[model samples]
Target: MFAGIEEVDWASMKHAYGPADDVPALLRGLASADPAERERALDGMYGAVHHQGDVYPCTLACIPFLFELVADPWVPDRGDIVELLTSIGGIDLGSDDEDEIDEDEAEGAANYAMAAAAVSAGAGVFFGLLADEDPGVRLSAPLALAALHDDPARVLALLRARLAAERDEEVRLALVEAAGRLALRHRPLAGPVADWFARLVGDPGPPGLRLAALAQLARCAPHALPGDVVPVVTGLLGQLRTSAAGPGSTRARPVEPPGQGAEAAPLTLRGQLRALSAEETAGRAAPWTADLLRTLHAGLDDRVAERVALLADQLRSPDPWQRVDAVRMSDRLIGGRRGSYAELVRLVGEQLAAPEPRLAESAAQLLAGLSGLAAPAADALAERVAADPADWVRTWPDGRTRLGSAATALARLGDPRVLPALTAALGHPLVPSELGPGVARLGEAALPLAGALRQRLSEAVLDERAYDRVGPVLVALAALRAGAAAPEVLRVLRGAPDAGGERLRTAALRALAAFGPAAGCAVPELRALVRRTGTVEAAEAAGALWAV
Candidate 1:
């Protein structure tokens, strides 16, 4: 299909990884009869030719060939080819005003402009593909048409018409999102598009469609957003959950019987496992539904209170996947914005007891990062920690056991109930770095574990790779005023290498200072460090010298 590919001077062009000589072979591989070879070729095209959204001279040359591949009905993964073209054309030029274009950026801007124009030239082909028989091709067409078409009027009109006739829920959602993006890019179309979104939101169509429209309306016209947006969204989400579980729902559809319809022959054990894995991956395969809600949450960016309320409703959803999505959104909101998230934090803490261990572990990890803000979840975290076996130290897939995460979260909130887990973790061969800090936070409450901490510190002083463990151990010893640890502290200070031991030396000095007069034997080493003048180690030594 790529008749003139060899006529081009590919050797003269440059891609991300040097030469563009491999571009032709990769293009030809896209038309391969075998799907695996086509996938490998597509990965190569993205990894090198248009690496990380960069459009090089080689990328521009490949555009015509890419278009040819998309137009060929027999080509596999035509949708992916369309997406790559959109990304290459979507470079942000910053400002059209010449005064804003500095000399250094001018050449790059010109290249971006050229790539965009080249992609825009294929708008007619994309428009025709909107009606392609392949649902995937149809789904991807609206985005390319909206993003690259030169005439915004025709693009918006065609998208509106497509939305009317589209029966696929996912495609209908894409058409709505594409129309919003087109209006946002072309300001003059905002008013009309906003009106359309408002009408769709009020329609008696699928709750999913209305939710998508509501989110888009918030984006295009924030002033037009209804006062009861939170309530409207909450109600719509409830309806969506109901519909998803009822008969005739796509999500509720059972897996096709072996050898049925479009699916290939009877399944083997491995095939059935793969099918189940795909269904359970990331909670659900239909992310667009969750994505629409996320967009609406982002559109109400300034209204933190409203966002928090919506999250509370979502966290309480009967749909486990929606709860998982809410936990992530709660994390983002708590981390980025200043708001009253006590209710949100409490809701997230409730997930610590979720039936699914993965969800419960995720909730614990989130709570651990919240610091003092996680106080509302302290009881729940404490309960989780207490429920674990005294020797619970099994490793999870991500290297953190459930007991470790829960205990860490509980200890961060100053609960002493985590003492057992922290103490048990201390004796484990592979001690968690968090154990030291968790013990340190408890002050005298952790005094009972001082002997264990000192023993770990002595053992850690001999291992060079145990710096992560040593620093926190020293801090915990200093916090507890463990007088017996002074010898180990002095040994670390004296034996630590001059080059990479700056932090270790500083922590030792601080620990000795906390020991007060009990650290008199460290005087000689402290004086030597003090003479290293004008450095941080010298300052820390001087402080310890005065304290001793």
Candidate 2:
């Protein structure tokens, strides 16, 4: 081996940097007489194999050497080396080290190895360290184990022991973090974790830890936490949940001078919950029901409004258990003096005008529920519905609350004011045609407004910005029974420029499909559109041609 090795060219050794032979050479150089030579050899070889971008060989060769370098006390600033250790296969801290290791090295190695193992679940070799002599290592091990490997039994046993025997504050806290992470993923761990969580519920370690425990309890198994614990978490989360509502999470009502009509008590959880039940049983007819919700609704100041909204959101939740509180809050807001039918319509209007669509949808649902029974309020909502501008709709976008929900809300409201808005929306590029039923549902209320709408569509059809408007317009046209606008539709399909005309052609076909034989001349245009774009527009046009 020495005969050929001494003569080999070192400068041109990049080709020989493959893991198989290079790993041994680099390993032997770890304790070379010249530190520069040792450092250079390891750095060059590690860099080449890792960056070479081949997954298998790089992982196999680098794991042990990286661990050795990480353990080497002589090497300072080991973050980069540790990160390298994690990037390939994770480091194995569980491996029997024949040499005795210091506490700091063990902790550092445990943390670094855990981070690496998180990427590869098969890094079970690190699991045995759950019982490491160092508390930090013990605490950190569970987190690593939870991520890289999954065995609820082992995790449960370690956590149980830590909960029982762990006396150090920091270690106890780490155990809580581990428990939350474990319980959050595997619900079965909730029993033991909840025991630990219950101990710290109000004891107060750190704000972050408490919040984490609360979040874990809320997310994993709310019932596992004690009933007393639930309210504390609810109160804290309620404060956080409602921090945006008004001024402060809790508000003080003025003390009455002996007789202010039973001086209204500040809404408490128990009372609000009771009212929520009454509201559900009584529905719109129950006299006491609406008042229950109103009490909570009245709590909405800038400080408490977020809580109010959160409560309302909960009332509206699809989950029956959550609905009681949400209903109680909503009833109080909508039916009680604080939230009454009159107030609800106004609130809905405010949400409609709000920049956020989610708020607008909430307002819309409130309006929909109140429709007819709250006829005067619905009438008022109608006017605002018409004035609100349109927004783009996408099934999947980067953000959750987009403008489409507001449009849907308006449609769901079915108030007449929506007609002019819908007609005006014809030019909106993002509105989808699927909204026709919603617009049409508004019925003859929309009929009287059709003439004015036709003029807007005609004007919009000619504008350059009207490209995206074309499809939605046609969809709305079908919605409005604006069949007479067929000629205008045909003209746009035939003559509009390519820049905006593509949508026009597509909308033209869709409109013609909606128009049927009444649009006989549109047959040629429909065929043209289908050939130009392979969309439903083409298929609808072909169907329309046959229907004609």
Candidate 3:
């Protein structure tokens, strides 16, 4: 298939790893009889040839051979090859803002354009692959066509045709996503595509398709999104949960078996260790359908209210995986965005009482970050803490303790009921770093725990790697106005360079400031810090100096 590959002076070209001498061997490996060899080859192609989406001369040269592999039915990983081609062709040209391209970026831009054009020239292959018997190939083709095809109208037509005949749910979703991408890339086609997506959303087909269409519609033509999008999405999520729970249903099925798919990529010793570590650290795996719904929710982007509303329903879902997924989504949305997320917070709080300890722990963790916004969940969080104060010390499968998370949430909401749990956590060998902030939030109500905080701070100051633990303790001390900690706070400020980064230094300085003139011993150090201009530390030090 790679007939003229040898004629090319591969040694003369450069990929991410210098010489492109390995290009041909890698290409050959793509068609190897062994799946491992093929996976290794694809890894090399992406790792070196098109590293981090930067197209190289070797990357452009490998395009034709990649296409040949895609066209060949015998190629076991043709779908993955199609995806690689899409990545090569999908480089953001920054066409919308040509004026922003500087000289340093010009060569990369040119290479990207060349790579994209090369792939687009082979768009005919993808169109044929759209009908390929392999569902993987069929799934990856529409996106390639949408991304690389020069004729938007033809790409749209073929995608619609495929969508009509596509019975595979994954491929059908891909078709809808491709149509959205096509409309977004080619704005002239947006009106019609929005209409088509709207129709899909209203269709009586699987709720997943409708959800996909609704998400895309929110993206490409947000103005076209129906007023009832939240309710519609909520109902669709209910349907999805029902279908996923039904006997013989394939909705929540994993995309690939364990030890396969993207995780199956060849890895270096370090990469393998890191992957194993991540797997061990990650608790229970969520259902595959939860991931799909998360993607759809992400597409809603800045539509906070709608996203929150959808999360409420998801949190209420009977499916544990769906609820778990909702807890994660709530953490991101509520923590990052600004809005009245009371209802969402309340729903998340409801999960704190869930029978599943893991789900309750997840919900508690989410609430812990919300502070005042977590008020609605206060009663539930307090209940968990009161139920078993020792739960704070009891570790979960994910390495988090229940009452620890719940107590943190309660303390953040300014509930003094968590004082016992908070104090108990301080005496534990593995003190929760969050203990400091939660204690700080309670102000004088947390003064009883000041002795424990000071003891932990003393221990933390001795360990250089305990900088994260120290900073919060310093903040808590400052909030409590603990005059007794002024010496330790001064020690931290004086040894800031060895102790930690600017965070610890700032925290120490702020603590000294809270002690007012009682921390007069730190005046000279504070003055020196103030003179180190144009830094956050200097500003914080100046504030401390003024307070002193």
Instruction: Give me candidate 1's TM-score against the actual structure.
Output: 0.89
* TM-score for all models, in order of appearance: 0.89, 0.46, 0.80
Tens digits of lDDT, candidate 2, 13-47: 33334424465465455445444444444455455
Best of the two (1, 3) by TM-score: 1
Number of clashing residue pairs in every model?
0, 14, 0
Clashing residue pairs for model 3: none
The candidate with the higher lDDT, 2 or 3, is 3
Tell me the whole-model lDDT of each prediction, alpha carbons only: 0.79, 0.49, 0.79
Candidate 2 Cα lDDT to native: 0.49
Poorest stretch of ten by lDDT in candidate 2: 249-258
The true-versus-predicted C-alpha distance at residue 459 of model 1, in Å, is 3.9
- For candidate 3, what is the TM-score? 0.80
Tell how far residue 478 is off in model 2, in angstroms.
1.4
Q: Tell me the tens digit of each residue's lDDT in model 3 across 1-548.
A: 99999999999999988999999999999898866677678778878998988898889999999889998998786887998999998887665466777875777788888988888888888888888998888878889998889999999998998888888777888898899899889999999999999999888988878888887887788889898978887887777655743223232223232245655655543245535644432433323355556666666778888788788878878877678788988888876778888888888888888887778889988887777889988888888888876676656565433336787778888899888887777665445667767777788899998887777766664455445456667877888889888887887777666534667787788899999988888899888988999989889999989999
